[model samples]
Structures are given as C-alpha cells and as structure tokens.
Target: MSVQRSWVIGAADCYNKNNVGLLIRKTACTLKPDVIISVDGDIIKIRSESTFKNHDTIFKLNEEFDEVTADGRKTKTTVTLDDGVLVQHQKWNGKESKINREAKDDQMVTTCIIGDIKAVRIFTKKN
Candidate 1:
C-alpha cells in the first residue's frame, strides 16, 4: 500500500467570544495568513495571505465554470493570481482574454511547484 503525505503552513490564532448572559467559550484555529504545500503523485501548492500595502499586479487564469441549468446566470471562470497577471475566460461561448492589474499585491501571494518528486523529507525546528 502507498501512503500520501502532505504539509500545511499558516498563521493561526485562538479566540474567545462572550455573549450577554451567556458563558464564555474559547476556540483555537489557524488563520489563512499562511501557506499550504501539498505533494501527491504530482504536486500542488496553495497560498493564502492578506493584501500588500504597496501597489502591484498579479495574473490569474480561468480554471472552472458553474452555471444553473434553468437560469443560466453566466458566471465567468477565473484562476486566482496564477502569476503577476489575471486572465478571465468567458463561460460557455465566451472568448478567452487576459486582464491586467486585476489583483493588487495586498490580495494574494505566489504559488508553484518545484519539480518532479525524487525524494521526500521533513524536519521541525523550535524558535
């Protein structure tokens, strides 16, 4: 049998909320301001981050499209910041085009794979 291994990195936090006349509860979780890296037969990576204060452009490409069979609301297919550019493809019969300056630097981070998997290793360090 083959086992799959994955790694996720991100910022997390714990929070406590109290309602009036109610007991307080505490919860802990990781926030999205972090990055997630996954490895499979191939490799996939995901990154989530806050917006950058400075101005910058990011690229995106359309990946998938979903529509209601009855209404046909027609939603555009989009990929989130594939590179430094944003590309929007029309749904169904729409044309494929690119949009410049669609993503601000503050909105997202870059994500990509290194190369084919030859070996895998992991280590942890304390700060």
Candidate 2:
C-alpha cells in the first residue's frame, strides 16, 4: 500500500484569523467557514506524509474552527473536498513535526497539493 502525504503550509500560528478566513471564504461554495476548510492544488502524494521542499499548501488541523479559542492545540481535524466529502481527522503528533498516518481518512479525496509556500505580510488574493 502507498502512503499519503501533505505539506505543512500556513499554520494557525503563522496567520491570523482574517487571513485564514479569506482562504476559507474563497473556497467555500455555500458552507460556512465553521463547517468547512478548503484545500487547493493537485494530489501528487498522500495526506499523511509531508511534502518537504515542496510547494504544497497545507493547513494545520485542530479540534475546532474557533480562531479565538482554538489556538495552538493539536487535535483530530477533518479534510473537506469541493464535492462535499468530509475526510475526518484521526490523530497526529505535533511534537516531532512529523505527519501522522492515523489522522487521514481511508477514503480517497482529491485536494490541493501545495508546492511552494511564500510568506508575505498581506494574506489575500491580489488582483
């Protein structure tokens, strides 16, 4: 069996609630940010592994979506697809900065596989 991997992008520790909200809003079709988080790009790897030296955008998972309260807590999170498939988060270890195979669901869900990540002051879509 092959292993799934995902790159760690902007975590809650790096970006504020507003920036995170923008990403979610851009991808959210009709669901509220409270119910869904969006992933962008193509899948070249699994969801449990990290795309080291890659440009893939990865979102850190947490127990809740409350930006005010859900800060710095490593917990089981869920992955949402554009088609409405909720890949529930299982478990992960944040101490070693390693990907946890236990956190990914068994179903195959296609989402954005981040490649290069650029850290800028303004986190928004420029036109």
Q: Which candidate leads the pack in TM-score?
A: 1
lDDT tens string, model 1, 1-127?
A: 0111222222222222212122211211222233222233432222223232111112222345442211233445454333444233334444232222222222321222112211111211112
Name the regions of candidate 2 deviating beyond 4 angstroms: 1-70, 82-125
- Report how far off residue 102 is in candidate 1 (Å): 4.4
lDDT of each: 0.27, 0.27
Clashes of each: 15, 16
Candidate 1, lDDT over the whole model:
0.27
In lDDT terms, how accurate is model 2?
0.27
Which stretches of candidate 1 lie above 4 Å from their native place?
A: 1-63, 67-73, 102-127
